[model samples]
Target: MEVGSTRSWDELLPDALGLIFKNLPLQELLTVVPTVCKSWGKAVMGPYCWQEIDIEEWSNRSEPGSVERMLRMLIARSNGSIHKLCVSGLQNEPVFSLIAENARSLRILCLPQSNMSDSIVEKIAGSLSMITFLDLSYCYKISARSLEAIGKNCKLLEGLRRNMHPLIMEERLSQDNEEAHAIATTMPNLKRLETAYLRYINTIGALEIIHSCPQLEYLDLRGCWQVKLDGEYLKDKFPKLKVLGPYVVDRYERNNDYEDWSDFSDSLYDYESSDDENRFGELEFRFYQQFNEDATNGWPPSP
Candidate 1:
């Protein structure tokens, strides 16, 4: 990549640039290519590329407000071409408002590790009729009332990820139970479900998800320490599932021996096209409880 003189949009190749950007991820273009020159910047900020965004951050990146700045620019430049948004961090309300205000076209949204509120989720879910995938991992503050809104409007939804903390001492336990049950009943078309690392889970809650999403194929239940499935009976219910518990892709996990009651061959998925099928891998789950809020912010519980 090199520096070049800026050119006016009248001479811009919007179509060619769109094709180029279609292959580039959001994070890479916003930081590197878009900053190179005004011509490329205008092309990159065009509606076609900005409409559907995928932001991925690697381990060695810094510059606190860079992503925020880019997303804001895209929203302003594209005039709400953004429909399918995939984000990977905590975003404030201003950014959310940018998308929600022009959210009519949004279909799939991935906001893992977001610290979200119920009102915001309701607004987006209520407004976006075409939404299919909604991933909200590490957003521990979500409640059942907001989830109801999602089930109502996002009927065409195919995948949902909502893992938050369970309230043990609340008088709203009954409310929690019924709401959880309603989620299963409402989102019938969901094919993939995921949650964050939970120290424990009620068996009824677990059962509700399995029975509700009868067509479920990919399940990520990692970090759920207290939720145990009957290895024997689960064979019948979970035969189609491939991933279980939490998502741990780097480390190797050993599957625990459990009672086998169903035929695995009858339900296992074949995600690959005949020409592209190569890898067939299975992951196991693991977790721990409690961490210190240290005086100097030190993390404890070392293995």
Candidate 2:
């Protein structure tokens, strides 16, 4: 109320500062905000700011091994109170184990494009009992076995995204509906299921899921060329359910937001065919190259 009054931002409480810091990017939170003042630094270092850690953007642009190190640091800062975590490009086993050990309150976990395997899924199922939403899109290594384990363990789960790349002609012929059956039998509580771009599932699998998961409110079957839906049947049986029909090439051609063929522009997707045994090797090479370039130029500026 005075003409010459001065306000000190550093005097703000840690909880208030944390609410403000939550809006900032992970990179800025880690590097810029902390250096402003002692109070800001303390707030950034506390568990409040690390409750919902989303490193997807930073992980995509950062150097190799940097994402893992940053995850370790941030998870430690959270002090086991992390509730939602979204990460990409993870290939390490120990990091999954670390999350299982520490993040007991985790409810939403997104690991899109990560190299997670079925064994790892089994290992972490026990720790994921509290999870409500999970995203495993583009995780080709995961199978029906892992989905069974997840459904059994994560009783509270209501959302699942298990999207995949469209299968080649030969692979599609031999593909089974085991995954759909697993989801249908075990994950009855799911309300939202996204199985986009999965060429393996047919009408049988789709019917199985629709019949089993009676609570489903939203179902996405885009790019599933084999699954043919009867519109009248769906409307009569499940009037409240909303579904996205199979992919129509011309429909998504003008829509950039659709992820059906979004990754095809990347070099990695160029080798995504079943015959490409060295795909991971190439990915590692690219990661290492990027890291070397960043190190030489002093990227991230030591924070």
Candidate 3:
């Protein structure tokens, strides 16, 4: 403890090193830090550094099997203590099952643009009872059944992002409101719900969600062309609600309203801006970009 005395970096405790390493990118943690020294390697390989795993960036740049391998390795390192897991490019059921079995403490799960289906989600929802935040945006395979299962099981869920790209005109006309109804019926405790660009959710479904979820403070229905929101009514009913969408119905008649109206324009801005808008905006941009990339690149090739 002399003023001139020095300490080696390797002498630092694993807990302290884990805290420092958590800020580094996943690629660096996997490739660079462990190679520095034996003590650093041990620290990086421990559960402390793997508690909140975010491999989205790494997974996006890697091949399908590579992502799965890395996820399995990291999950093993976490040793049943992963708290927040956000990844993309998930292609199979075994990885999902492994997460449900191992990450008992996981609270936040984001798997945007993955190939997750109803059965897999239904099977895993029971084990993810502790999850508070879930993002399944642009996951085309998920439907109302999965939402219902998640709602019944993850009782503590506070935030959900189920954004999707706008469906074509033919598909939108035949699409049902089952997903919105499922959310309203089961997730009464939800405080934040983002369904941006979901083209099928009509006025009835939107009203059902608003009336059922009394605690909802943030709702993003942007690009939902079917929803015709009475802005005055919504403002009076839920004074605290912050909505982002085209709520005002146009008085002018047009033959192709549905086709042209959903486009984002300065005139469509009706909601009050807040900090949550910025946060949700970032998430929307990230997921939308990822969705486009996945579509163009065709990820998770046939097994």
- Candidate whose TM-score is highest: 3
Q: After the best TM-score superposition of candidate 1, give how far the Cα of residue 21 lies from its true spot, in angstroms.
A: 2.1
Q: Give the per-residue lDDT digits (tens) of candidate 3, residues 120-227.
A: 999999999998888887788888999999999999988888876543222555678999999999999888787876767888999999899998877777667678
Q: Write the number of the candidate with greater lDDT, choosing between 1 and 3.
A: 3
Model 2 Cα RMSD, 1 decimal: 10.9
**Model 2 CA lDDT for position 165:** 46
Between 2 and 3, whose lDDT is larger?
3
Residues 207-263 of candidate 1 have per-residue lDDT tens digits of: 787788777765545444445566446665566665454322332233211112122
User: Which stretches of candidate 2 lie above 4 Å from their native place?
Assistant: 1-7, 167-173, 250-303
Error of 3 at 247 (Å): 7.1
| Per-residue lDDT of candidate 2, residues 154-238 (tens digit) | 9988888876544322255467899999999999988878786676788999999999998887777756777888867887898
C-alpha TM-score for every candidate: 0.66, 0.79, 0.82
Instruction: At residue 255, give the lDDT of candidate 1.
Output: 23
Q: Which stretches of candidate 3 lie over 4 Å from their true place?
A: 1-6, 167-173, 247-284, 287-303
Error of 1 at 51 (Å): 2.6
Of 2 and 3, the candidate ahead on TM-score is 3
